[model samples]
Target: MLQMANYEFIRKQHILLGKPIRQISRETGYSRQVIRKALKSTKIPVYQLSKPKPKPVIDSVQPIILEWLRQDEQAPPKQRHTATRIYQRLVDEYGFTGGESTVRRYVRQLRVSPPKAFVPLDFPPGKFAQFDWGEVTVLLQGKQVKVQVFCMRCTYSRKIFVKTFFHQKQESLLQGHVDAFEFFGAVPQTVTYDNLTTAVKKVLEGKNRVEQERFVQLRAHYLFESHFCDPGKGHQKGQVENLVKFVQKQFFTPVPCVSSLEELNYFLLEKCISYETTTVPRSSLTVGEAFEQEQQTMLPLPPQPLDCCRVVSVKSNTLSMIHFEKNAYSVPVSYASTELTCKVFAERVEVYHGNKLIAEHERCLESGKELLQYDHYLDL
Candidate 1:
């Protein structure tokens, strides 16, 4: 291949200087045939393959690889098979004798596709936030356990809040918002979310949604609007989606060793506070500075935050216990066989008799367990 500059020189020498092709090739150390082509046309010379290289081993497994790639389109993003995994699977299942590099090259060719274009989105300060749930594994009591993480991010300041829970139930979802509002000291005008079952009961056409009743109550209490992304389009709330990965990599790396979720949450809270002082990419001010300015425009906190809980009405059995969520919770003996309201919180369960609180106990995650308070049975 001839450089553009050399090609120009060769053409100029032959056409303008009246130099012969033989003389130009001798002077430039290029072949006579090359000098002739360059003089004939001023275009830069490039080498083009007449045909693609053959892949003997990989060709045999193309169908298998294509099948796997198609299946990956429906699989979870994080759990999709990587190049290494594909190679291992080939060797194990098909006794593939090809080298990993060969398979990787073929896979890369198959995976290449045109990229999608996106419009840049702008959000006003204190007006928008996004929420989502992520999963991570942490060491609790020296044992590895999986936990759900509730993540919220301010679209303007990029401020983040994260908390871990054992489940992604309705109670956890509501409590996450309550805690996040307290952390920000104000409420965003509108919060964005996906079509999560905890928040949305049904997704209608376009942006319309049949929201969960409890979730609507939460919005009404805080006087904030809710926005839900389109079905299967997680990129609509792209800020919080990225925030989930950022927290997982920056905070959850090394698999935090802690005694309980409380200890882990406290550490995470401290980390989030510390993160405010650092600068974000393509921004001059620290996150804390932006957050401070954004706070001025945010809605003021209400006189009281919403009490997030799931209320279940049940009648106490003859055993002076109310069964909820497949577990029996002891109430006062006097309330035996009486109707009571069970308020289930993320951390505790409270039984209320005619709006008067009766029994309170730590919430048990497991089922079929009896949570008996000795004082509740004292009358017996």
Candidate 2:
């Protein structure tokens, strides 16, 4: 075979080089008929054809395997069933008598679509802060549990603020930002966030975005703009992502537990301050100190703290009441059941009757349901 290939190569060169095939045959001491055939054929050497391998019985199960794969693809990644589990299920539920190898081959053929690329970003100083939530599992009162930690980082300063909460619902999410802004003592000109449902209602193309009404009010209160990264492009806020992992390692590595979320957040804030102190001590600058300097450049806090509470009219026909989130308060019984405005701050609620203070009460705690006793409104 090697010799035949070499002869074919030389014959082609002779023909292209304008040498006569008969003279080349004579010089090479080869048969005139063989040389004539090679020149006339003008075809590359055709290797012997190997027989096709027989299709295994697994090929028959391709349809079933593909159907399973499609179903898995449509399911959430966290909830999607695994291949081995799916194979066992097929055997038990569908009475699939196929061999394991067949199932494995089909599963290997399934491919997941690649995530979109991160959009390039150029962050300006005091311009953007990236926010995210991370879940950390810890032993609470000897019971294993998970807590959501809110993480925020300034893109330029690299300063970070972390706070833990029981849930990531809208109230907690908005409250986290308010607390973070207060902790930094400033608000970024433009804040960046993931496509969290709490903040963003819908994301449109051409950098247009729609935000939840409450979140929009939150933004307006702070006088800062909002931007969201393309879905799944977390690297757009890589600083905060690293900050989340850094907190996990520095604070949660040993799985420390405390009596309450407030206690955990207190310690986490202290640790963050300590870490920032060590980062640039020679310059005598801490993260807090740098943030204080940055605050000078930031937009001043609104004339008042942002109102994070929601307003709901109390359902009473006689006695007027106002509901601020989960807790309810009673106002003048005169405006009862009528729609009245309520102003809620971090720690207090002010019930108004057309710009008149009808009632005021400290926000209630989980145990203090009767904070606003209706009888107290008798004098009003």
Candidate 3:
């Protein structure tokens, strides 16, 4: 376990300073898992030295009281002695004169700590944002497949963006933000997250973070702050946390029968925008109305959207195919046995041979799947 000081640093950096875990890890040299462990604990994990209390009154009776309680551990829950019963028994048997309240207090200490309360939070207009991913089951091609729902919501205005992806990848992470920001027509000042692997590479002590290189590039492009909720502390980002559940229940309760993620996401976008007319708690204005007000405070959208895609070079086989991320895509036959470039966009893959476009195919998410364009084979 990390010392309380280290835990405090993770919380401050991740939750307050809006630093990503990767930045923390690079700065502190602590593993992301360790950082998360420290974050899960709300209280600092400091070991305080217990000062000896002047318990001369209970000193002699302490052993007797312990033995009785230890034996009672075997008794039925109903039959176990209550505090009053124990105090009476002490006076009748061993003649303990300690106050009943004192005995009751000691007994309480032996029990497990009480459950923590969920803290309530609200955001000021255009000040905060939240991002999270939730899984939903969809019926595609007569098979039930799980898909990732990337959700981003403006905390104050309740404006949101919902998109679906076949998997969660770093590219998808950046793309989700780009789409969300474009949808909202502005960028939020700070965005909160849980320790999502795409953006965070490590968790470090206090205000220090090691963010993913690509993530850092995305941050630099849009210039929004990144905040991470404590590990297991979803309540810190409770709005999106609840939104995750809400998306599943409200949008996906009836399993969506769709041919592709794009179709389902189109449906989700409508649902997202529909929330605009609903009134938020303690507010007279609709969600859309609040968003309209918050829009004035937002940072203007960039002139050109960031191209958040992953580009890589791969050697094409004799069959004019190249494998990437466990899936195979094809290029023109003339490019066979040569090094071809693949630009992986959010929804499609573009194959290029020396800057000339050879082929384009819709990206596939299923593992070990191959997409072949008949035009590429037509030359043969």
Candidate 4:
């Protein structure tokens, strides 16, 4: 048992530091022979190797296979010519006499190697957050419509925050982060996300990434670094992926409704808090209590909340109305021809001119044909 323990300790140290057996022996004052023996004796091979055989007849067809692979590089993956097909084509079109097995062996060698994906071994509480988006059908004014849910989760604590939005645009994505951070009462050190186009514009080699300007600004404002998962790897954000289902079942199952987005968000906030108060499976502590403890370890919140909404200049149309989304809002008759900036949020719309609030309208409740009236603007 002692020998086994020593072997495990040394093997683990080797894996953690990625040092060679000779180097480990040199540093630890163990004999090179002993280190080598221990590694050879205790190491469990992941897969057994097959016995080597004489080079096959396929070696002669390597050049042809390589040529065909190169020619098919730009073709669609499914449409790409395979070795078997190539061999058949050669037999039918040309007079080549190569065997199918030989051609397949050569073709296997020409396949582009799959890229290695990064997998984190362990992530500590408040160290990283993973985010993703999910969609669900919910009743809106007795009619069912699809709603997008933004899901974020802390890797270590398994704490989750979910919010529903209409779209997955940059504005919604940035606003989701702000709301998520505020919900958690602290900011994580690093955020992990998939290659969402709203956030990442391009993912360069060596994992060097370029993000949209607004997302970069949002990260800077929140003082957290961003890590993007490789494209086509949704499981890289597994924590949030799991939370998406959890939120859908635990929170959205009954399909609650409200007259406005503000009320819906208010109910969502309450549900999130209530979820945090329940005991997390396999852990004795409630999520809220765990989050409170986690919060102590996290960075303090910023003095001011992030301004996630965007200001857009809108021109009044001939009907003395301004268009925000598909919905129209009426301005004063005197200001019908003037341009004004509209401050849009998840639930509210505020029209302003030089810091002076002109009209505040609670955004339209349902999607189609809804309008914020001129008489309503006068009350504000």
Please tell me which predicted candidate would have the highest lDDT against the true structure.
1
- TM-score of model 3 (CA atoms): 0.69
Candidate 2 vs 3: which has more lDDT: 3
Clash pairs, candidate 4, are 276-288
In angstroms, how far off is 102's CA in candidate 2? 6.9
TM-score, candidate number 1? 0.77
Instruction: Write one digit per residue (lDDT tens) for candidate 3, span 1-380.
Output: 57778888888999999888889998999999988877787775666658866777667777877788898989998998777887899889877877988888777766657898854666789989999999999999779998889988898988888899887888788899999999999999999988777888888875456788888988889988888877777777878888899999999999989987778888988998898988876789899999998988888888998988888989999988999889988887888899888888867888888889888999887799999988988888
- Candidate 2 has an lDDT of 0.73
TM-score leaderboard ranking: 1, 3, 4, 2
Report the C-alpha lDDT of model 1 over 1-380, residue by residue, as the tens digit: 77899888888898899998888878889999888777677665678989987868888999999999999999999989888999999999999998999888888988898999988787788999999999999999989999999999998898889999999999999999999999999999999999999989888999999999999999999999999887889998998998999989999998899999999999999998998998855679889999998999999889998899999999999999999888999999999999999999988999999989999998988999999999988878
- Scored by TM-score, the top model is 1
- What overall lDDT goes with each candidate model? 0.91, 0.73, 0.86, 0.76
Query: In model 2, what is the error at residue 192, expressed in angstroms?
Result: 1.3
My TM-score estimates for the predictions, one after another, are 0.77, 0.57, 0.69, 0.64
Q: How many backbone clashes does candidate 2 have?
A: 3
Kindly report which residue stretches of model 2 are placed more than 4 angstroms away from their true locations once superposed: 1-99, 102-124, 135-148, 164-174, 232-235, 245-249, 252-264, 278-304, 311-328, 332-339, 345-348, 360-380
Number of clashing pairs per prediction, in order: 0, 3, 13, 1
- Poorly placed runs, candidate 4 (over 4 Å): 1-75, 80-120, 254-271, 277-286, 324-327, 362-372, 376-380
- Candidate 1 — what's its lDDT? 0.91
